[model samples]
Structure formats: structure tokens, C-alpha cells
Target: MGVVDEAARLERAGYPVIHLEKGEPGLDTPAPVKQAAIEALLANKTRYSHSSGLPELRQAVCDYYASQYGVRIDPRRVVVNAGSSACLVEIFLALLSPGDEVVLPDPGYPAYPRFITAARGVPVQAGSAVTGYQHTAELVREHLTPRTKAILINFPNNPTGAVADAAQLAAFAELGPIVVSDEVYHGLEADGCHSRSILEFTDNAVVVGSFSKAYAMTGWRLGYLIVPEHMVTAVTRMHEDLFVGTNTFIQWAAITALGDAATIQRQVREELNTRRDCLLAELPRLGLQLAHQPRGAFYVLVRQWANTGTSAQLAADLLKHAHVAITPGSVFGPSGEGNIRFSLSAPADQIVVAMRRVEKFLVEHPALAPR
Candidate 1:
């Protein structure tokens, strides 16, 4: 089984199931963003936009990046899509041939490999969390083959909340291949946490971002991509055929979201930071080993009890017995087999309550703890 089915089956079995499995934002879309979409609908702007994107939204995307990152983005280089996942599909289609190989880090996003396979490209797992989930220049270089086409990076990463610093990013950027940087969790960093822009490192890269995390707009179905000038036409053309541009109404709201991000990000980041601190402090006491203090995003990747068997079985046992639900790290990749990921997107109170039950279960099932 697939990850989604495993989750659905467990949910149907009626566990208390403190859901830490999904990565969606816990908060509702801010009022102004909602209002903007509604107003756009009422204004009859609900028509097909330019296949690349609405010029207005594309410009907003460009302006947002230029002002925030001090990086100049030609509006022509921005391609709006339903989500960054779709953007990934477009890039793969535009760049890779049937036999091309793409390097993706292990314990990385599950969809990366699936998407590459769907696009008829090969996914080469090149990096490991054994080195703190850091994909070094040497490993990336070693993975390079004549067929290698791109390297994918997810910073302030999912399931681990780990962010790559400047030197690490530069190493990948300087590697002679297309770099796809997934920066979806950019603004949701814990206190004093910040992610370096891939734009700052190289021009031979595409940065994928969304309103999902920072603006609490997951269901908004909105994401955009930044491609280098040379690849912009190909990526945009693929999006044109496959996605037909992002929803016009959602684009309107996303523009408003970019404008109002300061107010929304401050409130969301503060809460996520608090939750991260609480979970990090408490999970270890319950006998799980925290691989590290995740400086950004909202996940805690913990080592499963040594003899507790597979990550999937341990996650199943946690849900069935302790009334908690978390993602089995194995779903990400082979290197993730002995770990599980807990999401802090839920409220702190719920996390605390869930931890209590987990602690009790660990005590009763002593074998689930490290020997």
C-alpha cells in the first residue's frame, strides 16, 4: 500500500486518532483572502485567464519576490498553477525525457518519485538523513550520470522541518544540473528561523512556492513557480496545456494574500513556533528520540522504538492503541524506515493530550522503547 490508503483505512477503523499525518495548515484562510476571492467571483472575473496566468497575479508574484528577497523576477518568468505539485509535473515534462534520471533525497517528499515515474523519468535517491538530511555536493556529484537531468530540494523540509543553510544550498546550486527547490514552507519558520532563497545562489534553478503554508490557504489550490529565462517558455507552455492556468478567482485571492502576508505570517509563525517547542520538549520524555531540533516547519522526526518493527507497524500500533496518528517515515523513502513524523499543525492542547496517551502506551508496551 500506498500512503493515502493506509491513512484512510486506519481512520475508518475508529481510533481517537490525533491526526498528525497530514501537512496542511491548521488555520483557516484569513478573512481578507477569502473576501478577495468572493469579490472576484461577484465581479464576473470568473473567466479563463491567460494560460500562463493572469498578468496581474503574475506581476504580484514577481513583485512579492523582488521586494521580499531582493531578487528581481520578470513577471514573464512566473507561471501560476493549481499547486506546486502541478508545477513539478510541468517541469518534469518540460525537461526530462523517458530515460532521464532525476536525483531526489531519501526521506524526501513521496510525490517526487511518483511524479517522476509518472512523467516517465527515473528518480535516483541520492541523499540521506544520516548526515542530518543534508544533501552534500559530493553525494550529488557522485549521483550524477550522463542521464541525470535535475536535483530536487525541499528546505524547511516536510517530516523533518530541516532547512539547508547558505553553504549547503550553494553546493547544490553549483552542481551542473537543473535545481528544483521546493520552498513551500518558507514563512512558517519557528522563532528566529529563516530560509535562504535559492534565487540567491543560482539562476539555473526553479523555485516552487505556495500560499498553502504561510497564508493558511491549503485548499486554495494556488501555487506558483519561478523559472530561469531560458526554461520559462517550456515550463509555461506545459502548464498551459496541462493546467490551463490557475483558477482566476483563486489567483485574485492569492494576490491579496501576498499583499497581506505580513499580518498573517506573524500570527501563524508565532503559534507554530510555540507548538514546535512544546512537542520537542515533551516527545523525548515519552521515550522517543528526537533526531534533532527542527529549526523550521512543523514536524518532529523521531526514531521509532528499536525493536518496535517497521515504521508502518509502529505508526499503526500508535493509532490503534494510543489513539494517535502520525506518518510512518518509511512512506518518504527507504532511509526513513526506522522513524515516524509528528505534525505540530494541530493545536498545542491536542498535541499535549495526545502525548499523554502516547506516554502511557510507551510505558505499557515497554518493547516499543529503545532497548
Candidate 2:
């Protein structure tokens, strides 16, 4: 059984579940972004944009990178799409040949392989928990083959929350294969650490980013990709055909979201850090071992000493018995075996309330805890 089903089924059965299974931001879209969308709608700005997206919105994306990371690029290189998922689809479709191989980290985002398959490319999975789930430059180099066309990296990663090291990222840039960097959670960093954009090291890289995670714009259906000048034609051509363009009002709104992000970004980052600190300190009391303390993103994958069955079964038992929902690690890849991921995306209050129940469950089932 898929790991996430436990949450949905319980919700359907009206089981009074605490949802921590999804990553949708707990906050509403920021006020400025929302106001911009309203203005656009009232101004009749709801038309199919320039077949790539509004030039201004693309420029906004460029301006954001310059201001935040000191990275500079031509706006023409940005291809706006419905979301980062669509950008990934367009990227794989445009870049991957039928027999080409793309190196992906195991226990990585599940959709990486599926999207590669949809593009008729092979996803070569490689990684180990020994590296805290980040795709080490060494592991990536080991996976390289004559057919290797690209390598995918998701920093401030999902599930594992691992950030890339600058040296390793530079090594990846020096590596010959094309690089696809997913920086969807870029601004939502933890502590004082920051995520690296492949663009910082190589202009040959393809960058995927979105307003979803950082700006609480999940339903906005807006994302953009930065491609090298040589790859721009193919990517924009694919975007024109498959996605047409990102939502017009959303494109306009995201422009404001990028400009007015200072306060909200701080609020979100602090809250995530607070939640991360709370969970790391509390979950261990249940005797669940944190294989690694995640430094960024908002998830902690933990393993219990109990023989509670597979990760899926363990997740099911947690939901059924504790009334809490979490994701099973096996769903990501084999390296995720015996682990469960707790998403800190739930509101702080909800996380506190739910962990209390998880603590109670651990107490009742003494077998689930270590001595």
C-alpha cells in the first residue's frame, strides 16, 4: 500500500486525523501578492500571456536572483510554466533523448523517475544515508556513463532536508553532464544556512523554482525555469506547447510576491526552524532515532527500533493508533526503508498537539520504544 493513503483514508472515514502528510504552506498567500492578483483580475489582465509568460514576470524572476543571491541572468532565459512540476516535464522532454540516462539520488523525490520515464529517459538512482541523503559529487561521478545526459539535484531537499555543500556543488558544475537544479524551497532556509543554485556555479545548468513553497502560493500554478541561452529555444518551445504560459493573474501577483518578500520570508523561516527544533527535541523521547538532523527544509525522517512492519505499515499504525499522519520513507526509495518523514508544514499549534498524541502512542506501546 502507498504510504500517503493512510492519511486520506482516515480523513474520509472522519477519523479526526492530524494532517502532517502534505507540504502545502500553512499560511495564506501574502497580502501584497493577493492584492496584486485582485488588481489584475479587476483590470482585465486575464489574457493568455506572451506564450512564454509576461516579460515582466520573467524579469521579476531574474531580479529576485540578483537581489537575493548575487546571481545574474538574462530574463529571456527564463521559461515560465504552470508550476515547477510542469517545468520539470518540459525540461526532461526537451533535454532527454530516448536512451539517455539521468543520475538521480535514491530515496529522492519519487516524481524524478516518473518524469524521466514520461520523457523516455532512464533515471539511474544512486545515494546512501551515509551522506545524509544529499547527492554527493562522488556518488554522482560514480553513476556517470557514456549515456549520462544530466544529473538532478534538489537542495534544501524534501523528505531528508539536506543542503548541498558549496565544494560539492562546484564539483558538480565541473562535471560534464547537464545539471538540473530544483530550488523550489530556496528562500525557506533553516538557521543561517542557504541553498545553492547551480546557476551560481554554471550557466549550463537548468534551474527549476516556484512561488509555491516560499511565498505560500501552492495553488497559484506558477513556476519558472532558467535555461542556458542555447537551451532556451527548446525549453520555451516545449513550454509554449505543453503549458502555453503560467496563469496571467498569478504571473502578475508573483511579481509583487517577489518584491515584497522580506518580512514573510523571515516569518516562514523562523517558524519552520522553531517547529524543526521542537520536533527534533521531542521525537527522541519516543525513542525514534533521527538518522540525521536536517539543516534545511522542514522534514525530519526518523526510524523506530520496533518491528512495526514496513514503513508503510508503520505509518498506517501511527495514523490508526495515534490519529496522526506522516509519510513512509520506502515510498521515496529503498534507502528510505525503516523510516518515516514528519512534515513540519502543519501549523505550529497542530504539530505540538499532534506530537503529544504521538508521544502518548509511544508510551502506550512500550514495545515501540527503545530501552
Candidate 3:
């Protein structure tokens, strides 16, 4: 967020900075989704519904899972919140006691630990990037202790973009801790393969899903949690107390989003894949090593071979000199040090422009040349 703020400050100062730092879809909300919201508003569906979410939206979620993943879910187990972040906080609050530990992937989303800590839970880091950013059961088991309450996993991950297969999901399920699966990037795989859900392997997990990434509904601020039957009451109660309910018209639109998710997500995935391919092909030629071949999501974490300073310093320098904004890998976690993350949230042409600027900047500053 600091990088974002700094970029914003520069933009406000009239700098034409090329943005490769944001995590949302570069596209606009689909016409169908926006039209649904407008229709709902015109129909006076603005009144608050159940704190858990609109029943139709919840049912849509169930239907989506059934059709997409072959997983049958009870709508009663769905708890909609402002976003997946809210659902995560509510889950942590409902499940964690003070000092209870939640195992998270190192170089993971920086906010995961903060949320766990806010819920008075200890955040333990497991070195996931060591295995090419895969949060395997073996890695997580090594981090577990008696205090470990849950294992948080994000596939089609944020920075790394590495995804796990069903075998891996089953391995995680067998580990005994409650699996908090962040499936927000579910439909955004680059290889055109749909990522598997934890629910497909076991009913013992909690799924954190969002329309933010796959559906291009980031501004809509809608996400949901598919929890186990036993967890519904506690999680929903916590959500109700904190946020009475999500926007009613938005919920109505979400049902529309689900109804036509395949068409919307296909268009999104194709565009993102094009951008991802552009970065993957270009960055390595600039002497930056991709941390791994990202198979999903819209991020590419690259090792900056020339920089002698921290990733944060390199990122800041890039913003200052190249007029390109990228995230410092160090902010994600220790394992992320010495790298930078480029988000494919900009147009392909703009991303190419940013790379050209980076290449020029590196030339002028030969001290940053690869050793």
C-alpha cells in the first residue's frame, strides 16, 4: 500500500506513471453486471437483506460451485461480506483464541498475518516459495504446532501465481488443521485450466472467494465464504455484528455475475494471459529472473539481478526513475526479498512501455547491471 500511495502522490504531481502495481482487473465491470445492479436499484431492491447475504445470491453461489467444480454446497453455509478480507477477519475472529497460531505461506499476501494478528492469533510463516511457491502439505506440516488453528492457502496465488492440483489439495486436507482456502483467483488461470477447490477434496475447509479478480468486480466490494456446516452460525454472527449486511443491489447483481460468469471470466482470462505472456517473455531479457513460471493469476514476481539494495529500494528507484510502479517483493515476506512483483492490471501496450522504461533506466544506471 505504501508503494501505491507513493505512486498516487507522483500521479497527483502530474507524473505520467505507468501502473503495474494494482491487483484488480484492468477492465471495466461487465455490462451485464452493471445493468443488473441498475435494474435492482430501479426496482427498489435497495433494502437490506439477511446479514449472511441475499438468499438468491447465496443460492447462485451454490449453483456456481455445483456446475463449475462439481461440489455441492448448502446455501446455509454461505456467508457474504463486504469482501473476502472481511470474511477472513470474521473467520479468524470466530475460530481463533488469543495466541492461537495460523500457518500462512511466506511471501504470501502481506495482509494475511495482519488479519490473523488483529484477531489475536499468532501468524506463523512457512517457506512456500522454497518449493516454487507451492504451499504443499509437507511445508505446512513443518510449521504446525499445538497452537496452530488453521492453515491459510492461496492458490493461483497473488505474487507467485503458482497453482496446486487436486493431489496437493488432498494432501492439505489430510493435514488436520482447518484449511482456509483463498480461491479468489479461481477462474484466472493462464493455461485455461480451472483450479480445484478445497471443498472438492474435503468438507472440512473454509473457502474465501471474491468476484474482485475473476469477475472484474473489484469496486463492487463483494465476496463470500463457503464454510463448513458447523461454522456457519459463528461466522455469520460475527459478520452480522460487524457489518449488518452487504449492499442489496450489489447482491442482486452478483447473482447476475454468477449467471454469466463463464462468458465474463473467459474474456478476462484471455486478456490477462496475453499480458502475462508479454511480461514473461520480456522481463527475462532485461536480466530479471522470473521467480517461477506463473500458471495463474495476473502477477509475475521477478528477481532483480542487478540491484544490490533491498527490493523496496529497487521498487522505489524504479518509480522515481522509470516512472513505472511495481510492488517490492520484500513487503510480501522475507522470502520475497530481492524481488519485485509486476501486476498485469495494466494494458498490454502500457506494460510494454513500462518495461522499455525499466530497460532504459537500467542502462543509464550501469551500477545496477547484473554481476
lDDT by residue (tens digit), candidate 2, 244-322: 7667988899889888877777777888888888888777567778866688777887874567778887787789898
Q: Which is the better candidate, 1 or 3, if ranked by TM-score? A: 3
lDDT scores for all predictions? 0.83, 0.83, 0.90
TM-score of 3: 0.98
Q: Candidate 1: where are CA atoms >4 Å away?
A: 1-15
lDDT of 3 by residue, 1-371 (tens): 87899999999999999999998867999999999999999999999899899999999999999998999999999999888988889889888999999999888898999999999999998976678766689999999899999999999888898899989999999999999999999999987567999999998899999999999999899999999999888887877888999999999999999999999989999999999998888976688888877899999988776545988889888999999999999888888887899999899999899999999988888887653
What are the runs in model 3 whose C-alpha is more than 4 Å off?
none
Model 3 deviation from the true structure expressed as Cα RMSD, one decimal place? 1.1
Least well predicted 10-residue stretch by lDDT in candidate 1: 1-10
Per-residue lDDT tens digits for candidate 1, residues 1-371, read 34446656766875456777778758888899999999999999988999888999899888877777788889889988888888788778888899899998887888999889888999998757667665566777888999999998888887778888889899999988989999998987877767888898899999998888889988887888889999877777777778786789999998899888888988888988888888887866877787656878788888887888899988878877887778898988987888898888688888898899888888888866643
Q: Give the root-mean-square deviation of each candidate in angstroms.
A: 1.7, 1.6, 1.1
lDDT of 3: 0.90
Least well predicted 10-residue stretch by lDDT in candidate 3: 127-136
Best by lDDT: 3
Q: Which residue pairs come into collision in candidate 2?
A: none
